[model samples]
Target: MFDYLGGNFPTIDRRSKKQMKDVEMVAQLLLFLEEGVRAYSQEYLDKAFSDRDISWDAKEEVEKEFCNTVKAIKEILDLSQDINLSKTRLKNQADFYSLFGAIAELNRENEKLTITRDIGVRINNFLKLVGDTELKNQSKDSLTDYQRNALEYYEAVKFSFTDAGTRKTRIRIMKSVIRGNIN
Candidate 1:
């Protein structure tokens, strides 16, 4: 895991090759983060729908929230500052620290985005399972058969991120669910 405890975050002051390497690592990390969010969102959906006790309206709300959250995150990333290793700062620790903080935050956002995406995935999965199980047990024709299940299960499970927040609860999704349980 990347260490953000000592505050040695990803910054532009690092060596050219090292900075490039960090950028690549950050990109790959983002990919995993993105995939994880999508996966977990479906997982949440699956749980909510399969349980039968939860209302469809509630599931819909989760889905809506997931969608909106994803949109907002994407917008933030698009509008956020880009990491520029080209601007070398050899003597300025403050500049390096600021750059490091920016990189760290960007990376953190990727992780959060992944989690929110997974929440949507979970909700979706719950819906699918509910529909499948209901049909199987009731002898009723399903809207979607087991063989014909169309919901694509996004398989994106990734490790979580951890950090200390001053007087704030560290709500990391991969470690635990930030939201309330479906039941």
Candidate 2:
């Protein structure tokens, strides 16, 4: 992760366990943002498609709602201050994890009104396109360029979440994998 930062830095000792845990917390925040984007985007798409004719007002409204929700999520995970100070909000790691679990449950309950299953199918199709022959045969440099363009298009036109909704779906799948829940 630090390699992605792109700067010369002095060598440091290996991270402590606490530092690793902090990194995990940051990872969770990233996951939440990713799912939040998907959920909000899907909400916008659903509104756009609900009527036979797409209304500019409806599209703007959806965009407004999505922006607001994303702002709220960012506030909840604010990293502007020292992370050690922020960790005081949750008494322990267990509490922190449980908070995400509760949030996932709440997100799941709220997703019944949306067409997540259909969206999931669309997302699957987009993934298949990304992995098709052209992508598979490309040189690494060309593949990187192609993937960036393709993914941008995919996100703009085809991104979606599984039946469980974005946030809850990721949580559920992670739990399932951890628990050996595969069929």
Candidate 3:
């Protein structure tokens, strides 16, 4: 649904029929990555909280999970362009809604993101909890199944995903999530 540049679709300079097909394949692969980004965000949040050795919402730690599938696709496709426009090859981004990538969007300027709707509400009753820091020193918080999966996937990626191909890693993680086999 999205690419890197403006957080929109990828633009392709008509290269070859083969290149076009490859781009199409990359597009399909990236489509599944939206959830991967979400899972990564969840893992990031959980790790940040756990490593703190205390319960506190650090707004600075909150960040929207985003993917640079465009670059990955470019690398995968081995795309390049000469200094002159004569050799141009790839272009993307007719439009993009950057906020769509955020787990929670407070407004046009708010940068607070959440792992999930339930966690966001638990952290704060407000629609926007990012950077609010009202979180108390609570003991073990209940995590959703998605959150658990995200955490498990994080550990899996840490070990098995090391030195793997980026595109393959993304697809593998997505498949694990779909199969509920992240453990």
Q: Which ten residues in a row have the lowest lDDT in candidate 2?
A: 4-13
Residues 1-183, candidate 2: write the lDDT tens digits: 223211211112256334554444433433343434233344444453454154444445444443443332233334323332222322233323323443343444564222223322332333355446565455656545435443433333223332224334344432332223321
* Candidate closest to the true structure, highest lDDT: 2
Better of 2 and 3 by lDDT: 2
The C-alpha TM-scores of every prediction are: 0.23, 0.22, 0.19
Error of 1 at 59 (Å): 1.9
Candidate 3 per-residue lDDT, tens place, 1-183, comes to 223333122444446434554344343333323223322233544464465447534322332222332332332233222222111111211111111221212221244321233321221221121112232222226644444434433343344432224324333433333223432
lDDT per residue, candidate 1, 97-119, as tens digits? 22223223434555443334443
Q: Sort all candidates by lDDT, best to worst.
A: 2, 1, 3
Error of 2 at 161 (Å): 7.9
Q: For every model in order, what is the number of clashing pairs?
A: 28, 0, 3
lDDT of each: 0.31, 0.36, 0.30
